[model samples]
Target: MSSIYLVLDMQNDLVHAGGPNGKSPLGEQVVARDVVNKTARAIAKARDAGVPVAFVRVGFSPDYRECPKGSAVFSGAPAAGIFKLGAWGTEIHPALGKREEDALITKHRVSPFYATDLEVLLRTLGVKRIYCSGVASQAVVQATVRDAHDRDFDVVVLEDCCAGPSAEEHRNSMQSIARFCRTESSEAMRFETLI
Candidate 1:
């Protein structure tokens, strides 16, 4: 079975130190976990192991037309002036070293698979197992695990590569998703083994 690394929601608004989330607890955990650097190393390892990498970003148009109204999570995007596509906040953080050949999956809502081409891309890549890592473990990471599991795809989540609103929240979310997927830290997961 082929595997792909699906890195989610590492956009500036969510993980960068200067972004809005930078002032939030999520940012604290992000920095504390050193996710950007660790994920960068992991990406390099994946590339070395010949594992394809895909990045999932949540963004909306300048007018926010693609954004869903009354979404508890995304409702504030328009008013807050964040998550606008083509904006720095929505762009993947520079530390990840995204390449043009890497698959970029853009979504409007919390779930990358929701109304997005993520599943299609997975199928196209002949990917049967997804190695997942992302921000806000309570949201996108868990959603990816659950949805991908439901779609009959094997899922492995890198615990250290993910963060949440708080440390406790991140742990709790990881525990919740453990039911649907395997969880491992970036350091312990060997990309070649998964491939």
Candidate 2:
């Protein structure tokens, strides 16, 4: 079976410097410099192994208000300011080394598969197993794992490649995801494991 690394929304809006979603102190606490470096290393290993890498980002159109203003998420981010397409805050985190050919699956909500073409892209690539890694483990990682499992794909989550609001949150999210998917650290889940 073919394997692909679905690098989740490690966007600047969530993990990079001066990002809108990154403005929170809690976000910073979880997304330390070491975590970012480790994630980059993992991605590099995947690239070297010829495993296809896809990027998922959460962003909206040029208009800052493309997202509905009445959802629960709106209560915390009512303005949807960071979702803008071309804004620096919405760009992928610099450490990921996004390439011109990398596929991007954009969603308006927390789930990368929600209203996105991610599933289709994976199917086209004949991907039977998906390895996920990204920020906000409690939200994005959890959602993606659940969705991937429900879709009948073999899911592997790189625990060290993900973070949450706090270290405890990260740990808890990994524990929860482990119930439905395989959990491994980036160090343990190198390209060799998948290839």
Question: Which candidate comes out best when scored by TM-score?
Answer: 1
lDDT of 1 by residue, 64-139 (tens): 9987888899888999999999889988999999999999999987889999888888888778899989898999
- In order of appearance, the predictions have TM-scores of 0.96, 0.90
Task: Assess candidate 1 and give its TM-score to the true structure.
Answer: 0.96
Q: Which runs in model 1 stand beyond 4 Å of their true positions?
A: 193-195
Span of 10 residues, lowest total lDDT, candidate 2: 73-82
> Candidate 2: where is the Cα deviation over 4 Å?
74-80, 192-195
Looking at model 1, residue 142 earns an lDDT score of 90
Per-residue CA lDDT of model 2 for 1-195, tens digit only, reads 278888887877777756665658546764573667877888898888888788888776675455766667533443546667888866777878888888888888888888888888888877888888887788889999999999998898888788887888888988888878998888877563343
Clashes of 2: 0
